[model samples]
Target: MFKYIKNDLPASIVVFFVALPLCLGIALASGAPLFSGLIAGIVGGIMVGALSGSQIGVSGPAAGLAAIVLAAIATLGYENFLVAVVLGGAIQLLFGILRLGIIGYYFPSSVIKGMLTGIGIIIILKQIPHFFGYDPDPEGDFAFFQVDGKNTFSEILETVNNISPGATLIALIGLGILLLWSNVLSKKGKFFQLVQGPLVAVVIGILFYVFTKNNETLAISADHLVNVPVPEDASSFLAQFSFPNFAAITNPAVWLTAFTIALVASLETLLCVEATDKLDPEKRVTPTNRELLAQGTGNIVSGLIGGIPITQVIVRSSANIQSGGKTKASAIIHGFFLLISVMLIPRLLNMIPLSVLAAILFIVGYKLAKPKLFKTMYQLGWKQFLPFITTVLVIVFKDLLWGIGIGLAVGIAVILIKSYQNSHFLHIEGEDVDDGKIKMTLAEEVTFFNKGAILKELDKLPENSYLELDVTKTRYLDNDIIEILEDFSTKAKNKNINIKLISERGIVENPPSYIEFFKLRPKTSV
Candidate 1:
């Protein structure tokens, strides 16, 4: 891990810049103490990164969980919510130990893509308000309808009325710097590469804030600036850490909240792990079970020290990967940066404008929801496209879980519809002949879904027909399908349809019982 420091160090600086506002933003969105986000970021970086099997995946306070955390905190109180976070971590650990990691693989690729795209749209919409310095809703709130009673689009209109020229200017500059760095300067030399676009944007934002302090028309208000908790003294800094209330351990509400957090956080983490692995240039696979354990432990530690719940966040993970991170060291280093910055330079960080961060996030969002992705999914056909679009739309209109649920439902429906359509094929051989020869070829895997088709075709067969039941190419025959064939054999006698079972075991003529005949297990060529 240390060997990659040359690459990891620069990447870590980029991730640190990316994670800083997000940590505070998510905490602010959750209605938790501002410092709680920093704590989670630190633990996610140092502890989780150290333990995780992923080389590129980064864990931190997740925006996806902010809504849940917000409600949970309100319902259980801050201290009690910490208890829930701890228990949630424990539950995640249990999930890992039980080897339930494979569950992540069950999500359809379309649904997963939809998730990333939906989150991308959310990021763009949520940050738009901040880009113009609207501060009624917190920085990281991404719901379609906000806590302030305004929807996503309405807030944009409101932002126009409430725009701070200072913030808008800074945001424009930040975006320009980012675009230039990515598109031009970074390609010129090592010096330009070493100077990350986000860091430069943040520095310029800080300088702009300082220079315009006395200007009434261009001064950014406190509401539009990064709000790290500034400690005046050592004692006050230490007082920021809030411990979980052990007495709440006996509360059933605490346990319920814990399970909810564990379930949601683990799911979000697993999904992010999948996305990050795919994004990796080397295509390295992260151990999902181990990731769960790492996250669980991170949450436990984070809660013990007054932090929000942590998960493998896609925003930070994507930023890390895109910034050329080659190892987990970048993640760890970013955590240390969070720790040192908050402890040593909170005042300096507080001077950075939120608009700059919003500008950076905008770029990230665009990359995730690139227009090309839509065309690619559409070209894949509706079987993939429907679920992908549904997930994206639902996520934009509703919440993350709801979007995923509806998307998964649509995906499953597509699968079932295909299964019904392709269950079997009935070819009436030698039509218009005195003796009809019907050939029924079973699909590769004949399940209960094919029973209706097979039954209907059997009923349509003319009297004294010669029917050939072909299973030679089938690798699996469901018991229900076998029963259907068995029952059909008994009914075939009435139609005077002579049945021949053609399979890998050769043919059986007028089989007394389909099950009995199959039990013979005669070996034949494919």
Candidate 2:
């Protein structure tokens, strides 16, 4: 890992810049203290990254959990919510021990794509107000219906009446720098490659804020700037850490919230693990169980220190990978940066404009939900496109998990429809064959849904006809299907239909019942 320090160290800086605002933004969205987000970021980087076996996946406070966190904090008091976070971590540890990590693999790809696109659109929409210097709502709030009772579109309209000229200018400038740095400067030399665009935008934002302080028209307000909590002294800094109320452990509501956090955090972590593996240059597979263990530990520590919930977030992890991160060391390093910066130069961070951070997120959002992605999904046909678009629209109007659930439902319906249609095919070998000499070929996998079609086909066979039932290509023949074929065989005999059953095990010539002849079992393994 040390050998790759040259690559990892610089990559860590980029991730640090990307994660800093996100940590604060998500906290704001969650209705938690801004410091809590920083604490989660620190723990995710230092604690989780240290324990995790992943080469490049970075963990932190997640946007996906913002709605849950917000609702939980409101339902349970803030102190009680901390207890839930700690218990949630313990539950995650149990999940890893039970080897339930494989459950993450069950989510369909269409739903996942829809999730990614939905989040991207949310990010873009949420940041528009910040980008324009309208800071009535806090950064990192990604919900369609906000805590202030305004929807995403309504907020954007409100921003028009109260746009900050200073913020708008700096945001435009920061976006220009980001675009140039990524598209032009980065390709020019190693210097540009090593220097991330977000950092440049932030530095310029700070300078612009400092120089324009006396000019009211060009001056961004304190509300439109990064607001890191600054402690007056070392003791005051130490006092910022919050501990959970142990008394809340007995509260049933607390337990319910904890379970919700555990379930959501674990899912988000697993999905991020899959996405990170895809982004890894070496394609190293991170142990999902180990990842859960690591994340559990991080969340426990974060909760103890009054931090928001942590998960392996795709945005920061993808940024690290894109910035050429070599190992988990980059993640660890970024954590330390969060710790040290908040402790030492939080005042400087406070000077950075919110608009600049908004610009950076705009690029991240654009990357996640590109126009090409929509076109590509559409070209793949409705089976994929329907779920993808549905996820996007639902997430845009509702929340993350709801969008995912709706997409998954659509995706499953498509699969069932396709299965029913493609269950089997009937073929007559000879040209002059309407004499019920039919060959019925089963699909590779016949489920209960296919039973009706199979039954329909068998019943249509005329009397005294030669029927051949083929299962040679099938790997799994469901019990329902097996029962149908077995019952049909008995009925066929009464009709004087000569039934020939063919399978990989050999052929049977209407000698016995279908169940007894095939040695049917409750479940068939492929």
Candidate 3:
């Protein structure tokens, strides 16, 4: 794991930056205390990252759970919610023990793609308000919209109207610097490549803020600073910790919330695992069960200590990959940084502006949903492209899980259609006509879908033609398919064509009609 430190260090830095605002934003969205998000981020990185088997997976507070968190909080008091989070962690741990990580493997690939695309769209949309400096919530609102009757579109317009001239200008400069650093500077030399674009932009943004503090010359304002919750004293900082309400364990609401967290967090973790696998440069696979156990442990600990639930987050994990994070150490180190930075350097931390952070996230978001990504997936083939495309659109229009659900449904439908239309003919290959004899091979499975295709192939046989249906490799044949073959046998006889069913499961030896041909009478019918 340490062998890749050179890359991991850089990647960790980028992921840390990316996670900061998201941690805070998600907390705000969830209507939870601001500190909860940081706690989750720290736990996700350090606790989850430590126990995780995934080399490249970075865990953090998930935006997908924000809505649920908000609703759960509203339904159950915060103290009760904390209890749920702990139980949720336990549930996830149970899932791991049960070896349910294989569930991720069964989720159709198309659904996964849709999930990523959907999250990308949501990120762009949600952050637009932050980027434009139109914060409708009191620097802590993390819900879909402000409680003050402002919606997403209204907030977008508000950003335009209440746009902090200073923030807009600073963000643009930061974005420009980030773009140039990534696109141009990074390529110019190793020196530039080693220095991450977000780091450079952040530095410049801070400097710009300082220089223009009172110039009356900049559009950005001091109020736009990164407003993480900082305690007035050391003891007060520690006081932020909320112990679990043990009495709440008996509450059904608490259990419901915990179950919700477990399922959602587990799903997000699985998605992150798959995504990380796709993004791994070494193509190393992580043990999904281990990931669940790790995440479950993290959530449990975090909840006990008053932190939000977490999962393997794509944004941070992706940033970690891009930044050259070599091992989980970078992720672990970032968690330490999160803890230490909040505990020690909060005065300086408060100086970092949300707009600046928004600029950094914008870059991360762009990289994830780049046009090239779409084009490349398209070129991979329809089998891949169909699900991927649907996933992207579903994710864009809806939230992560919903998008994935849609993609999964679509993917399953495609499989069903293919299965329904499956056949030994369209799938047949190496056909050769020798002395009026034709030979072809069938697939491993012939389901009801293949009936039509198979029938077409049989119907096309020329008069007095000799045909061989190769099913030697076949394992399972549906009754619907068997009926198709039986019908075709009669047609074959009428057309004066010879038919053959080559399979280990063949019913007849010789001197058999279509009915007697494919049906091997059940042995010892009792």
Candidate 4:
């Protein structure tokens, strides 16, 4: 673990920049104080990173939880919502204890890709208003509409009319810094590489805002400022801590929210674990069950301390990898950085412009949806590609979870269709049959699904003198199918035909065991 620190420390800086806006954005989306999200990020980084079995998974406040948080707060009070969060954490811990970590494996690859792509599009879309310097009721960027009730596209139209010239100019400058930071200076030298592009862009954005203020020619204004809440003193800062409402523990809504957050957050975490492992330079696989336990434990602690729900965030994890993180140390250190940075440099943080962070996020967004990424997924197979592209597009146009759900449904449908096709009625082999008495064979594991086809073939076996019913190699035979054979056998007897029974169990004596007959027979090659 310590070894991971040395290698990942550099990468943590990049992750820190990426995690910043996300923390704020998710908090804003959750209808909580902006600092609450930051608190979650800090604690998630420290606690989850330390306890997690995963080497590459990076924990932080998640966008996926934002909707839950928003609805919870609206339905329950903010204090009640905090109770839900804490309760959610406790529930997740219980899940870990039950060893339900493998649940993450059930999510198909297509669905997971759809989820990530969908999230990427959301990040880009949500950031658009901020990039234009229009707050329009600061819910960050998680909705189809502005908090003012204007839809996303309508908000954009409103942004054109209400765009603060100063914010736009600052944003453009931030964009320039981001472009230069990610593309140009990044390749210059060892010295330049150590200094992240987002950091420079942020600094330039802040200073530019400060310089252009009230200058008609430069066009900077008050609305273009970072709205970081300023605490008057230590007492006010410390007063932000929220306690869990034990009374709400029994409420079904609270329990429901807890399970919802745990399930969604855990799924997101596992996907991040896999994706992060893929991005690993050493290419090590993180212990997934162990990761679930870690996240569960982290959420419990975060909830207890008044932070938002947490997950293994991919944006930060990927940034950590791209920034050259080689171990968990980078992830752990970033958490410590968050803890120390907020407490010690609150005012200094206020100096950073949102536009600069936007620039940084723009970079992160580009990395996720890069055209090369599209081409690469496309090459994998249509099974992977169609859902992935569709997911990204829907997620861009609609909601994140909805896009993922759609992708997952489509992926499952594709698999089931293939399974049905592969499971044909009869896989016939041997000489081509021009005669009425044709031979047919069931697959090794035949289910009742194949009964219709088998019945049709049996009906066509004209009152024959010689008909061979071979089940010597068949592993599974459903009772419905057995009944079909029995009916045919009785009919053959009426026709004075001899039906050969070549099976492990005699056609007349096979019992109605659900699935045991299939496994009892040792595979025989004919």
Pick the TM-score winner. Answer: 1
Distance from true location, Cα of 518 in model 2, Å: 34
Best-to-worst order by lDDT is: 1, 2, 3, 4
lDDT tens digits by residue: candidate 3, 124-237: 666777777766654323334456876556677767778777777878888898889887888898888777888887778778777777877574565677767878898999
Candidate 4 displacement at residue 265 in angstroms: 1.9
lDDT of 3: 0.75
> Once superposed on the true structure, which residue ranges of model 1 sit more than 4 Å away at CA?
423-526
**For residues 319-405, what per-residue lDDT tens digits would candidate 1 score against the true structure?**
888888899999999999999999999999889888898999899888889999999889656777999999999999988889988
Per-prediction TM-score to the true structure, in the order listed? 0.80, 0.79, 0.78, 0.75
Clash pairs, candidate 4, are 4-327, 5-329, 166-220, 475-518
Query: In candidate 2, how many Å is residue 390 off?
Result: 1.3
Looking at candidate 3, what is the lDDT of residue 372?
77
Candidate 1 matches the true fold with a TM-score of 0.80
Q: Best-fitting candidate, measured by lDDT?
A: 1
What lDDT does candidate 4 reach at residue 288? 71
Worst window of 10 by summed lDDT in candidate 4: 508-517
CA lDDT scores, all candidates in order: 0.84, 0.83, 0.75, 0.68
